[model samples]
Target: MNRIEKRMQELQQRGEKALITYITAGLPDMEGTKKLIRAQEEAGVDVVELGIPFSDPVADGPVIQDASYRSILKGTTLRKVLAMVKELRAEGCEQPLIFMMYYNTVMSYGVQNFADACVEIGIDGLIIPDLPMEEQGELKEALAGREETVIIPLVSPVSGDRIPKLVGDAKGFVYCVSSMGVTGNGGQFHAHVAEYLKQVKAVSPIPVMMGFGIRTAADVLPVKDVIDGAIVGSHFIQLMEESGYDTEKAKEYIRTFKTELNA
Candidate 1:
């Protein structure tokens, strides 16, 4: 099993839920991103999702949009991000690293080349929002022999009939969009979120994680029993922004968030 699968299994055995944190790569700059990642891991984050900044992040909210824009302006590309991950691995950062990017980025990098790079750099999994389950064949084929890395599937409350199809061959975990809106809206979850997650967990072989609008422990409490983990993204970016990208401030938030998650 890869780092993600092992980490999830470890957490399960310990009877602890995972805390997955997201940060835009090259946000304040590449070095800053590296420091923030290390800080989050030290603060008890279980997994890290490196947001590969894209020009048009359709699923992102304003906070993430601004972060992505700044990162792009800073000249962060897929190549640079991959190289950075390599550096992180070489530096002994062991937390499971997952890439959250658009499929266009992968296509531009060449499918086989991208998969090879991920394997070489030790990336645990990927979360491509734009790549539908129907169109994942090419990437899946590219990753065929390499079972260490995986393509995580996403399921939303509105994904009524497609839930099974989406998670049927899913690896790593199932990312459940807690609400109907884009990331960082911090709105209330759909009325039957518990039921929705129940459906997903019933069919999913791996862990099911809740994301979107999840800011604090309170947001997770409603579905805490249903989900295996919580993903914090927009709120994390906002924290970094508020602190002017100070690593300490962001780490403090992560520590508190993690404490609350376990409490």
Candidate 2:
């Protein structure tokens, strides 16, 4: 098992859920992004979803969209993200890291080449939101040589009967989008997200983690029993943005957020 699989299994054995956090790479700059990642690892995050800034991020909410735009303006690219990951790995940061990007970035960088680069740089997995379940064959072919890189699957309320088929292909934990909209809490989660997540967990052989609209630790409580973890994105970005990228504030917020998730 790779780091992600092992980490999830380890959490399962401990009877605790994971806390996955997301941040756009090069939000302010590459140096700040690296510091934020190290801070996240220090904060006990189980998995860090490093978002590669994409111009047309249809899946992201305004909070993340703004950050992605800022990050792209600061010149974030797949190559730079991979290089940072390599540096992080070289420095002995063991926290499992995954790339969360649209498939266009992967295709633009060359699929096989991207996969190889991820493996070489020690990235644990991927969560390509726009890649349909039916169209993963091409990606799978490109990943044929990877020994441990995983492609975590996603499911939504609109997925209907395809939950089983989608989770069946998951190598790491399944990422279930908690609501119909994009990222950010929007004040509250969807009315029936808990039941829907329970259904997803029922079919997912690997653990199930809910993303989108999960901002705070309180958000995890309703779904924690039904799923394996929570993925927070826009909340973190909002925090960083509000603090104007203050290094200490970013570090403390992530630390406190992890404390809340584990509490």
Per-prediction TM-score to the true structure, in the order listed:
0.97, 0.94
Best by lDDT: 1
Clashing pairs in 1: none
| Superposed model 2: Cα runs more than 4 Å off | none
Worst 10 residues of 1 by lDDT: 181-190
TM-score of 2: 0.94
Clashes of 2: 0
**Residue 67 in model 2: lDDT:** 90
Q: Please, what are the lDDT tens digits per residue for candidate 1 over residues 159-239? A: 999999999878899999988878986857888999999999999999999999888877888778889999999998888
Clashes of each: 0, 0
Where does model 1 exceed 4 Å of error? none
